[model samples]
Target: MTQESQAAEANASGNDNLLLQAAAPLLNAVVQLRQAVTHDDPAGLRQSLIDEIRQFEQRCKQAGLPFEMIIGARYCLCSALDEAAAQTPWGTRGVWSGNGMLVTFHNESWGGEKFFQLLSRISQSPNQHLWLLEVVHYCLLLGYEGRYRGSDSGRVQCDAIRKRLAKLIEETRQPQSESARPLVEVHPLVSSISRPMIPLWACATVAALLACLLYSALNWRLGNDAEPLLRAIYQTPLPQITVGRRPSSPQALLDLRQRLNDVIAAGQLEVSDGAFGSKVIIPADKLFAEQGTAINPVGRALLARVATAMKNVKGTVLVSVFTDNRPVDNSRFASSYEFSFARARAVTQLLQSQLADGHAIRSEGRGDSDPLLPNDSNENRTRNRRVEITLFAAPETLSNHQGTQ
Candidate 1:
């Protein structure tokens, strides 16, 4: 395949990964809880599942958001989550980007508690499929050979579940005209309300309910401990972003995406469309030696290729560096923020000499504050440690600090 095709494929795959990460927690929980369905004494597993679900709920609290986690139900908790989505790590755009998912379940099998924790991870990625949880759950019921497959976990093997699956398949095969009721139900998120209410009370009701929902969902008051979880979301990917002043057109974003893909190695970097024009994500390891400010030889070579690619592209170039939520124990810089800023400046310097004078560049240091994923595992931490360079379509966006330093 061509380099551009490869880049497109990688971006699609990366977004899928973002969705999978979001869906894993709640999906695992629900799938596990479903496993307990076969046990004569499921209380043990049920209680354990509750504890895990509660942990995710607490983490949401740590993020300063309260969401409903229905323990066991057969329908998607769509609107409840839609309302709580804004306070989520990725916001509403992060929530699978599907207006209505789970439209193809074809049966009463539901994705609930076990899948809720994963919902946030799914939201973290762009253009995510909302139906992933349902697909995973449906496959589990069919005895699919995957981790979430219910057969391996003992839930799908029981005579009752087997009989139920057989019946579901038979019903799914029936012609819609011959069936008494439609096999598919529209997911609640996109389904219209049954009745109308006054707009005035809706605002007051939402305001009143938010407090009660948070209090009821969390039960006890938060102590002084959850402070570290709530940090400001990084907003300066572009220098000064004013709405309609960017991206000459949607086609402009597409062309920029293709151009970057031609020069940057697909495996080495990530390329995608952004609110600006195009955004490229490169791992810090690819750009710098460990704990050093200067760009390594390999990094310099990659940046050189990037500079050559955008030589004629006129736009605002921003080099934003981020650090994982780890202490800068032995680094020369005092903290992660300083270290990130220093690297951004170093990378920006390399690109300035090669690009045309019309292209403006600025460096931004976004410490451990803005992360794509929670800094929980070594793999996650590594993913969070990276650099972002955004090329805004609008020219002359930066008025100050054009290229000082």
Candidate 2:
């Protein structure tokens, strides 16, 4: 064989080596995951799956393979884990609540199976890299389940993942030549009609139609119709819309919730939608240093940032604070309720001072009433003690409904 053939064979062998390096760990992970599932050990299953993912990631980096391969493999592994989770008892498949506590996975069935199917289509196609990048993005968004979205550390990790995926996509993108279309000979009868008999008249008629459209558009832009038209076009802060005589929160609030989710997810907070409005759940420990109403420096800074986020929200801010099941000494505060109430009041004061337009701020203290996680461990107790601030667009409906009674 010639030197050129030898070189081609060597390159093909190197490609095979890389492929095996990436696939071997994934295959082993799958086998171990299946074994864990067969034994019905949720903890073991979760651990093994995560281990395999890490191993695969390491192997990919070492092999210098494209990120799309890793992403595709990750999707498959996560799907397998989800399936195994289905077979396990519902209570056993727990989520790692960013604060070291294990919380119940709220929606176990929302891992984008349909979206994954669409992604799988790119496996054999030349554009697999681009499509897999999209898959990575979709998976990242899915990982933002209600529980993890409140974690600050979680947000940072997600941002890092996004940056890495973007870099990989940029590196892997391929340029394609535009496909050339075959020219066809025009049919004689159609060709004869194509050259308009009154060319000037045709042009004049088209120009006249364009002028009418331009005049109508200008009139709409300059008149009372402009505001509504523009609002329809660039609807950012979505105004409230009526649905069957019931008014819903504006789209702006929904968008605001997403924005808040992104920010608070980076920190040790969680964002959720409640009946009243959107809410941010902050751990009580983070807010107050051991057993005191005085806000710590960290807590104050966090609240200040939260206040800034809420400044534009035209709604009532409700700061509901709670304590864990542990008993507090009545010497410092009369009762747990009082301590919680005091904490809420302090936060409310800060928000009220910052919020523009004199937005109403409501403070509630429910001592040990709600427990997010079972108070089994110190971590669980820490998670249980939290302050949830809920924001509603407007309280007019609430007031009106109360007035009739």
Candidate 3:
């Protein structure tokens, strides 16, 4: 083998060894997970597994291993429980909370401090963050009660984080094109091994004979089968495609638009009614607490006026917050997406009450993504940090009534 091929093989072997080492601590946990999936855990097993995980994490950190490998493995187990429940022969699967004591995959606090630590390591490798995302998703899925739990707003935030982690994994998982490495010439003796060649004309004649026989056989069989096949085809029903409804024109919402105009004029807000949809944009600094997620008094008053004006609007209320591409170090918010989500939820909660009958409040946190302007200058970044509220109707509906997978 060439030196280049040898080096490549060695590198691959090293990576496999490291992954195996990281997964070593979870041997006992996997056994426990099997029992948990069957709902057959023995007494005291829960606390014992939790302690093992906690110690394993501490050791991983102290030893400076990829900090998130353990987290990812535990999450993989939890996800396994969900899959089992889904595939159960017994009726509809309710919530799958069989993750045992690994609710957040840690005995540690599921508060801001721990989350901040996780967020601080966003600069770490994708392998690291995949593990962190596993933990974050645990907080959302495992019936853990917190500010961002069991709420539409929290789900939206978790979804944003999930999307980010997915993208990271996808980017890193791509097969890298190896650069051409210089190779040494092989010996003539090694290269001389060869197979005898067949005559092309003889091979072609054999192939043609076989093809003719196969074609005759097919023709005979098809002659017998053709009538039945054609009959079945003619009797088969055509599929019906469902045409979707489009959004009504903005002219229908002119009265509501005019009412929202006064609120737009009073605050640092922008309004646009276009072919896509009608949206109200409020600057984040004007609508939220400085470097915080809570809506300030001014923002509250402004949103309150908006809610009052749109009380009669009949549709799902869409609230989305976009933050600038800036790293955050606050005690409350660990990342810009979390910050955006919290504010979006705050706005969503305030506006929910005024929603018309059957109207639901949905919020999203698009952090430093899909920016309104490039973050080249401070002014541009500021322009990108904004909140959008849409009086959603049929067109703005991302999915149908049951939601698309």
Candidate 4:
């Protein structure tokens, strides 16, 4: 195959692999959720909900997706739903708001009939289908609605997800055939008298109920010293990808080390052999402007050299950025993680721009979560603010070597 074609094929394969990886956990979570709801076990339902959301959050991070986890929202509580709805008076609605990604759940009333109806809708609605697609989109390394940029694993993953979304969008837009009901259809109102609002005094009826639920939720969380879980109907997790044996044959390992050494010798970065692979650290002061994601001229030059050195390696490169625990509230970034992610993405873009083929590169922002040094000292905090790049043999490359052996 021509070099370009080979690169294209490798990228497409990687994309599919990542998507399938993310989907595995999600499918399992969905099944568990469906089972919990079907059996009417509220405790199991709540636990499953937490497990699934945590998985989604982790998968999004691993896959390099953009959506943030709303940790403060009490997602699995029926009380949150009731309170949100009760405020509306005439029936009620619950919407996944804040982020432009809106998820609307149809729970007209919190009665026995509505409970069963909600369960039925979740199991058999286009809304659920659309929701799955959205989760996958957000789980993708690419931002939602991103296009295929070509010849990279991350781009390929984005491409595959975009295609899936296109198919879903089309399916959602087309007129429903006779066999398939519209996912969400307006119900016919039989009579106005049949649908009556709760009396104003009835608001008092829920006051005690709401207070009890709030107290219980707070106590449960405070007792455990854990964050309260939110009660939302959307979100899920993807499965983990199994890594192959490391391709660290003595000769190859030596060659890779020598290349890293050559760069380290130039004084632009630091390199050390890590447990899993070779770790390359580039100081943020060198790669980025103060509080910026844009690469400086010096940063671009260093990345170009690193990319050139790594172009022929049959491996994937993970470029992740880390930041100190300093508060980022006054800045444009909403959180430290967002700031770190932007810097990582900026570095990845520069590296990819210089690379021609063979090296598979992706980026992640770890935020202030994984600090390398104690944050108590300014020098230590400064040490924590750096970008780390690591190299690992692609699974296919390792598999091919084993096959030859």
Better of 1 and 3 by TM-score: 3
Candidate 1 lDDT tens digits, 1-405: 433343234234323233223333544433333333234433343345345445544443343322321211112322222222222333323222222122111011122322433333333331222234333333333232221222244443333433554354344435432644421222333466565566978878987999797854543222111212112213322122123334335334335556666545557777777555677788998888877789999889878877776666677687878888877664345456566767887888899878887776766666677788999998898889898888765434322213221
lDDT of 4 at 23: 41
Poorest stretch of ten by lDDT in candidate 3:
105-114
TM-score of 1: 0.38
lDDT of 2 at 334: 40
Of the two candidates 1 and 4, the one with more favorable TM-score, higher being better, is 4
- Give the higher-TM-score candidate: 1 or 2: 1
Question: lDDT of all the models against the reference?
Answer: 0.49, 0.53, 0.52, 0.49
Off by over 4 Å in 1: 1-242, 245-254, 262-266, 395-405
Comparing 2 and 3 by lDDT, which wins? 2
Once superposed on the true structure, which residue ranges of model 4 sit more than 4 Å away at CA? 1-243, 248-251, 399-405
* Clash pairs for candidate 3: none
Angstrom error of the Cα, residue 227, model 3: value is 62
How does candidate 4 score on lDDT? 0.49
Tell me the lDDT of model 1 at 267: 71
TM-score of 2: 0.36
TM-score of 4: 0.43
